[model samples]
Target: MDNQHVDAWKDMIYPALISKKEELEMLGYEQATPEDVWKCLSVKVWKGEPEKRLHEMVQDIFHLKSSVYLSYLTIQSYENDDLAASVEALLGNTENKES
Candidate 1:
């Protein structure tokens, strides 16, 4: 793949992996290592425990509760295209708060 394609893949891959991790967690399976998650994604060699690293990386990239909620909202947004309003309703004026 070209550099642009590689970059796009890299960008898209992480969110999909994150979504998978969330789905697995919801199903009650704690990922053993980030590498395990990556191996499962078949995207790359995971460098560390998937659970811990994924959790840490997610938190680093997104605010604590917001990241989780954002991930959830993103899914819903795609599902119905009304997630923005849904998020506004769920969060109320808090949605306008500074991040």
Candidate 2:
């Protein structure tokens, strides 16, 4: 995949994985790698058809509960300015409202 799509994947998935760190540790995966967390979160997000679910998630990031700044930070951590810009463009003009 291209960098833009890879960035979108990281932008959507990494935060969810990070948020599960404590949970994964509590479940005896104290040494969990990013790949491990990715697997775990992917399973939790969709028990079946993960690739399809992930595609849907990429489309849904705009509707995520996370603040725009937080999302930007997550994308920036991966050094994907293009994805960060895409995220900002999607969120910049919107009112802060939870769904």
lDDT of each: 0.45, 0.49
Q: Which candidate is the best by lDDT?
A: 2
Model 1, 1-99: lDDT tens per residue?
222322234344577556655765675556423333544333222233333343444443333233443454456458576767787677976766745
lDDT of 2 at 92: 71
How displaced is residue 23 in candidate 2, in Å?
0.7
Writing each residue's lDDT as its tens digit, candidate 2 over 1-99 gives 333333347656666556554544565557645454444334334355334445555444323333432343455457677878888877875645533
By summed lDDT, the worst window of 10 consecutive residues in model 2 runs over 61-70
Worst 10-residue lDDT window for candidate 1 reads 1-10
Please give the lDDT score for candidate 1.
0.45
